[model samples]
Target: MRAAAAEHGLTLDDERDLTPYLDLRRPRDRFIAALVGAGRPLPLRGEYWRMLRGGDALQWCLLNGLLNYRVLYFRPAAG
Candidate 1:
């Protein structure tokens, strides 16, 4: 990705340098901070935390749905 961006004369900043501004301790904290800062309702705070910590699979599904996914197939791993 760096190479691809460099080809177009665009330099991407490393994320490590922005940790202080970006880190909110956890996903839940970030969500709460954003919602509260925007003066939005807090009723969904717990729900947001649950959805985030649910698992990668659930997170993927949530993101996919938000992006208007049409169809998805899932198969359990063989034991």
Candidate 2:
């Protein structure tokens, strides 16, 4: 991902420094990958930003539903 971002003149170093704005879950990475695939800028809170930036209220609701599910059922348990 870093290499790909660099090819486009975007420095992934920003990501490292912005980690505190992220959700600290693997699914957040998936969401960022989705946004990158869509040719959008990386959001400040990653998936949370994506949902907030949805084209309509319905899309926002749907993405939030999915994110809720991931948080409830898929996020790894803390060790």
| lDDT tens per residue, model 1, 37-58 | 4544444457655554444334
Candidate 1 wrong stretches, greater than 4 Å: 11-16, 26-50, 54-79
Candidate 2: list runs displaced more than 4 Å: 1-25, 40-79
Best by TM-score: 1
Would you list the C-alpha lDDT of every candidate in the order shown? 0.45, 0.45
Model 2: lDDT equals: 0.45
Candidate 2 lands at a TM-score of 0.19
